[model samples]
Target: MLGIGIVLSIFGLGFFCWLLFTLAVYALPFLAGLTAGLAALQSGAGVIGGLVVGFFAGGATLALGQMAFATTRKPVIRIIIGLLYAVPATVAGYQVSFALAGIGMSSGGWQTAFAVIGAVLSGCTAFSRMTLLVPPPDGQGTGGAYSLADERLHDQRH
Candidate 1:
């Protein structure tokens, strides 16, 4: 029974860490949504209204960020947008990593180091994922007639 408990705890921790990593990019949108939800509630909106407002606010925040990142041609502008999303994720990562490290290790220095590593990885992951909002640079994956024609023309020349 004790061994089973230990195994279950390990699995739970792994699942939690996976969830945290997957959701890190949404931290900024989540904060926005939470704030909007609380504001709506404070203004006497019912629970359902608060939830609706929060959901919309979060969705809009994410969509707008992705749109701005995807549509902009300037590298500097894209960096700025990526940073906006990554900053929150990095901070959250630091906190989460520290807590996770505390579950096993007793050394504060090691915990801090792991936390820093986690922050960097999480921020980088969020930054890279920004590209997912846009189509591939080659345009072939978009399934457009232009892409097919371009391919055939290139094939004939070669």
Candidate 2:
């Protein structure tokens, strides 16, 4: 039983880490949702009402960010949008890493160092994920049949 418990603990930790990484990109939306939820709860909304409000708030935050990222053409504007997503992820990563590290490490210095590293990696991951919605560089074939037709013509020409 003891051995089984150890195995299960390790498995749980691994799963937790994976979940952290997978949801890193949603940090901003999560932040928004959490804030809205708390506000609603404090403002006399019932539990179910707060939850519904929070869900919509988070969804709108993500949708707006993606749309802004996809529609903006300027590199500077895109970088700003990317930073908005990354900054929150980095903060969350640091807090999580510190908490996780406290489970195994004792030294304060080491824990902070580890947390900072995790924060940087999380920020980079968030930025990369947001970049997926970037607009085409040349503004051509951004959507519709044009981009498809352009690709076919390029293939035939070469």
Candidate 3:
């Protein structure tokens, strides 16, 4: 029974991590909404009102970020936005790493190293997910398309 419980717990943790990875793009917005809602509730706003305000605020922020990312053609601006989007993931990564390290590992260089590794992985994952590469319209070659011919040409160019 103990073995079975441990196996189940591991599976549950894996699933939770997978879900977190898949929904990383929404983490920031959800956190913003949650914070706003809690503050409003504490400030004497009714539960419903607080929830409504939080939902709209969060959705608007997420939409604005998405629009900026979609409309911008400047690489520098896009990179900046992408980095902002990854902030939540990086924070979560650091926390998770710290927790894992605290469980059985030492509390010095090893913990810091784990945290940095986690932050990098999570930040990259978030950035990639948030800044999706949309294919150019009408099959026009934009050097972003992945195909055998494109690969061959790219290899030849190098």
Candidate 4:
């Protein structure tokens, strides 16, 4: 019975990780594209312009989507929160790249910076999600130590 339980728990954790990975894969692109589109439109670019916007927007979207779903039940709220979290990171990445590569930093430099920032921001999102999913103290049972409760409940007496 104990062996079966352990096996089942491992399977469940594997499934959850797969689900998380799938969600992240889909969400980030959408967010980045959306933001980019809005930016292009606001700047008076044409349809082609919006496409460019959407590309970036999709990445931003994905990052936020991951973070948003990490802890909350509300998809809308999660997306909003995710967006709030991703935008600044994105901006900072662009700025830092420009600064590091010099005032006239090449586009490649900006791209590199964006990638680094995006990765860091995504990590933050993952951390937040883990935080949310972790059970509360009451649910943690025995604080990871061998508890008197466990001994009383399941210890086999000789």
Candidate 5:
């Protein structure tokens, strides 16, 4: 039992750290794009403004995804909401970039590429943070399990 506990604990912690790392990685570029977009907005870059807004909006929505995860115990439902919010954000980001570059929305692959990247970054980062913060079902997996142990132990007794 002790070994199992330790193993589970270690895996949980590792998973949490990985999540944090992923958040940071995804956040950096998204933030950079957001900042650039805002700057563009200031300079009358309407298209850029759109890009910035789309990126930040997606990021904000990603945070919402986190909230959903924290409040809901159902993984499938959480994922659906997260994806629904995030996927549109990504698509919007791509469209904004094309508009910013003065390219038509029908510009084909380039716009799509931007959208895909934005969505991937936002979704991965947000999901990482959300999953870490939320306790898993079955009471077996969650980030910060070590810190939650005292409470979990108490709950176990009840």
Candidate 6:
């Protein structure tokens, strides 16, 4: 029973971490809102006030980040924005990696190495998640289409 419990706990932790990595972009806003709401509540704000503040704070942050990314055309500016999104994820990943490696803060080099690896992995994951995939051109129909003739006919009707 003890062994089973330990196994289950480990599995749960792993699953949670997987979700975090996979959904970091979406998760970030909720985390920001929760943090802000708790802070507000602790500061003597009423429950309703806290909820409103949290909702706006989270939504604004997400919307602003997206808008900045969408509106910017310069490569350097876009890269900077991407880095902004990635840095927090990298920090979180480093913390998780450090904890999992069982390396004390005093362990210096090993800890640094693991943290770097974690940061790289998490940064890439975050960047990939944030990127929008463009749809294929209409001219390139799915293989299910019988031929270009069918595609041309369908296109003409529309």
**Global lDDT of each candidate:** 0.89, 0.88, 0.77, 0.56, 0.58, 0.73
Give the lowest summed-lDDT range of ten residues in model 2. 135-144
Candidate scoring better on lDDT of 3 and 4: 3
- Tell me which residue pairs clash in candidate 3: none
Best by lDDT: 1
Question: Each model's TM-score?
Answer: 0.81, 0.80, 0.74, 0.28, 0.35, 0.62
Each candidate's root-mean-square deviation in Å? Answer: 4.0, 4.4, 5.3, 18.5, 15.2, 5.9
Tell me, by TM-score, which candidate is best.
Answer: 1
Residue 121's lDDT within candidate 1 is 84
Superposition error at 138 for model 4 (Å): 5.1
Question: Model 3, which residues run further than 4 Å from truth?
Answer: 104-108, 133-158
Candidate 3, poorest ten consecutive residues by summed lDDT? 134-143
Better of 4 and 6 by lDDT: 6
Give the count of colliding residue pairs in each prediction.
0, 0, 0, 17, 0, 0
lDDT of 4 by residue, 1-158 (tens): 99998788778655644453334334446555776798898899988889877876676565555555565656577656655545554454344434434433468756676556644554455436434543444434566454666666676763
lDDT tens per residue, model 2, 1-158: 99999899889878866777778889999889989988999999989989998999999999999999989878899899999999999998888888887887899999999899888888888889999887556634546468788889999999
TM-score for predicted model 1 compared with the true structure: 0.81
Name the lDDT value of residue 54 in candidate 4: 88
Name the 10 consecutive residues with the lowest summed lDDT in model 6. 132-141
lDDT digits (tens) for residues 1-158 of candidate 5? 99998788778655644553345424433654567677767788698566967587656655665677678866689787655545543444444434433332466676666555645554565545545666555535554566589888989999
- As a whole number from 0 to 100, the lDDT of residue 32 in candidate 6 is 82
lDDT of 3 at 43: 92
> What's the lDDT for residue 117 in model 1?
93
For candidate 1, the lDDT comes to 0.89
Model 4: residues with Cα > 4 Å off, grouped in runs:
1-76, 103-154
